[model samples]
Target: MADTEPEKTAPQEHVHTSTDYPEGAQVEIPQGWMYRSRKLGPITFPWYASPQSQLVLVAFVCFLCPGMFNALGGLGGGGQVTAYVGDASNTALYSTFALVGFFAGTITNALGIRIALSFGGIGYCIYTSSYLCFDHTQNFGYSVFAGFFLGICAGVLWCAQGAIMMSYPPEHQKGRYIAVFWGIFNMGGVIGALIPLGQNIHTTSNSTVTDGTYIGFIVLTFLGACLAWTLCDAKKVIRSDGTRVILMQHPTWKSEFIGLWETLISDPWIICLWPMFFASNWFYTYQFNDVNLAQFNTRTRSLNNVLYWFFQIVGAVLSSFILDFPGMRRTTRAKVVWCSLVVLTFAIWGGGYAFQTTYTRAEVNKGANTPLDPSDDYVKMDWTSHGYIGPMFLFIFYGVYDAAWQTSIYWFMGATTNNSRKLANFAGFYKGIQSAGAAIIWRLDGLDAPPPYMNIFASCWALLAGGLIIAAPVLLMKIKDTVSVEEDVKFTDESVDDVVAHKIGHEAVDQEKV
Candidate 1:
């Protein structure tokens, strides 16, 4: 029996290196798909097959659809959620974002990427469509349900997206891949940001959005769902070139949780990142969403989003290249990450400064003191709200901050471990904590508008500061003396393809004998 038995297959091993490889050198890419390049002129670079490239391209396109919808959805709050739902319903719409974010990750782990992203996208499509009914209804129930649904969708989508973005790229070129991924991700933000600009959202002081804007958002939201399917299925293990490595079957739920918890408890550095993970999304303006809309004016709101995304896309793309320059060392990227705290600090404190300096006492007082209603336009825009310049700076610098932290953290995780699936679990943990923090912020924001004089933005400086306190010490210890590192790229089409084929052959022989 022992002699007759088939030989067992070996586990796949991932290889990484720190030796600097020259940029654009011919490296072994594991992909099996190709794309035509039109960069030269009317003609093209012949189709180069690489499945990995296709995944990245599809992911980018998918991101834009949801990003645009998300941008437009921001307008729904503060009495604009719908005419009949009223200002109070803003709580339901805004808070759900935090509520479902992390939980979605667990579900993703259970359902795999395709279900997580597809349903999440579908959820957005429904949520966006529901906005069409906002003007026609007064029950508020539908609005609440839609908001909850969207929140759940957002949570899962972000979790799956983060996992894929971080894990799928080859070890050697993760920085550039991340940059392109995030750049495309935010490009959607830019498009969505511009949508509101056309609505001339600034023309009136009332909390209102144009119908055309709603139509655009709905169509775009559905389109994102369509593209969601174009990405690689999570049920398969895919290599850098988008070639299938192996079919991934579901593990028992018990083992999954056990593994997830083991990964979390075993890593102190990751645990350190947890607090800030929660704090990261906590600083946003939703707590003041309705009031700010009234006090600052729609132009300020729309333009801020537009401006935020523009610099963010640029920053995200550039940071990717800078972090991975030919001669750049790990120490350099580490330094940028450490420096991010300064921007983080300034960005945090700057929000309050902008709020205080931009508007008059009367405008601040009115937005804060008055009862919010769809028709109320008591608060006015201070053209001098150059104070928004603060967030603009933040949007720009935070772009750097986001680029640094997100890219660095993912890179750090990969550098620390060879297990891509394990890395995803870690991502889930981080995202879960992040969502919890965001949800808490939303929950609080929905409950009460921060005091008019307190600069709701000002009060949270402590939470972020506290988060940094935990994050900085751990990160510095881990990266304080980083060295330059790079992946020595190696791959060949037939050789790489043969590995998978060989494994399939073994499995086939075993099956045939059985």
Candidate 2:
């Protein structure tokens, strides 16, 4: 595990036939238009079967689901007239999400990625529809129920998403693949935010989003659910290098449960990641409710939401360049990202503190000092306000910090292993722990005397700083230059099928060539 030692690596085998594949394995490359290469003159389109293409598909899957979900979150109070119901719903959602996500990996392996992902896509429609119901009737219970149901579905959906996004790419391409996925996924946020910005363009008062907005979300999420069935099975996927993706035999229910425990024990260092995961979602309530909603009009909040997610794309792109910088050692890349995150965390949160000092949620609620109408004055910063640019830029930086933080975590997990099965479990644990922390914070945010905005800002800064500190030892000592097939094979119950053997000699290409 030391940084200087040679990392474990699988030996190369130059195979030339299907029979050469390890026995009892149907590891043949998938045959279909999507899986076949087409040459139109000199240009050859990459096969849809390629890892890069599959990763792009998976990214769109999230773009339609969680990407829209992020848009709703960014709208503050889920685009409702008040934050109370939204806060209550998120508390219920994360509570169930924490419990279900911990076991979703076992469910994913037993069900297979495609089936698990299909079920995962179903909950967003339900969650989005509940908001529509809330719009018609003042029923908080419906939103809470929808949130709880979506949490269960989200648990499975995200674990499946993480498995594909993390396990599909070659070692060096992990960061770029993650950035690609993040960019596409957050595009859902960007477009989803536009729905309300355009709808509420002339309305400056605090009010609920129209039925048209909720209906659009429901339709998009439903389509995203249907796309899950199109994903290639994990075992049949071949990398650009003609090596098969790493996956073991189909898992039995009992074996999956056992693998979950093994995933933890086999790599105890994963515990170091728990804190960072816990802190991952901790800032949402503060950024969404406290800053964007409390200080901006309805249309302005929508505009800021657009900018927030847009900058997230920018942030993901920048981090990928640093983390996947060519010819750098994986550990050195890890250190570089870590240092950058630490510096940004301090600088951005410090700005957040200064902004927090300028206004209190209580003052915003009562319309104490603003010159505008009481209905609209709960917000101080407006799209037309003279000093609006300062606070707007602060919120934008928050988005950038968020993307960088999340991309680094995914890259770290991908660096940790290449096995789809193990990566699935790792993804589940990450969501579980992350939701557990989110549940607590959301509950706190919903309280009668929710912690002061200042307290929320300080806690976010402390948790982020502390998480980096806790993660240092693992980054310094445990991360390897590369993951090997043998290490992944030991984590699962079955040995690797060595499915890389195949007579696709002409298709084999260097990683750079791809």
| TM-score leader | 2
TM-score of each prediction: 0.74, 0.88
- After TM-score superposition, what is the CA distance of residue 16 in candidate 2 from its true location, in Å? 12
Give a tens-digit lDDT track for model 2, residues 282-382. Answer: 99988998888788878999999999999999999999999899978999999999999999999999888888899876777674332112344444566
**On a 0 to 100 scale, what is the lDDT of residue 469 in model 1?**
68
Under the 3 Å rule for N, CA and C atoms, how many clashes does model 2 have? 0
Candidate 1 weakest ten by summed lDDT: 484-493
For 1-514, candidate 1 gives per-residue lDDT tens digits of 3578777864333322222322332223222233222321232211221335644654554565567654663443522622224223333543565555434445666777766777777766666556567655644577668767766676677767766766555555666777777777777777876877767754645445666766777777777776666554542333443223221244556655665666566655788777767666555443235234535566566665666667767766766765566675664665665576556667645654664565443453343433334334354554355444555554455445555555655665544443434555666666667656655555554443434434456545666667666766665565422222121111111222222323322332121210
Give candidate 1 regions above 4 Å deviation: 1-58, 73-106, 234-250, 286-294, 351-379, 382-415, 453-455, 476-514
Task: In candidate 2, list every pair of residues with a backbone clash.
Answer: none
Candidate 1 residue-wise lDDT at 471? 68
* Candidate number with greatest lDDT: 2
State the TM-score for model 2.
0.88
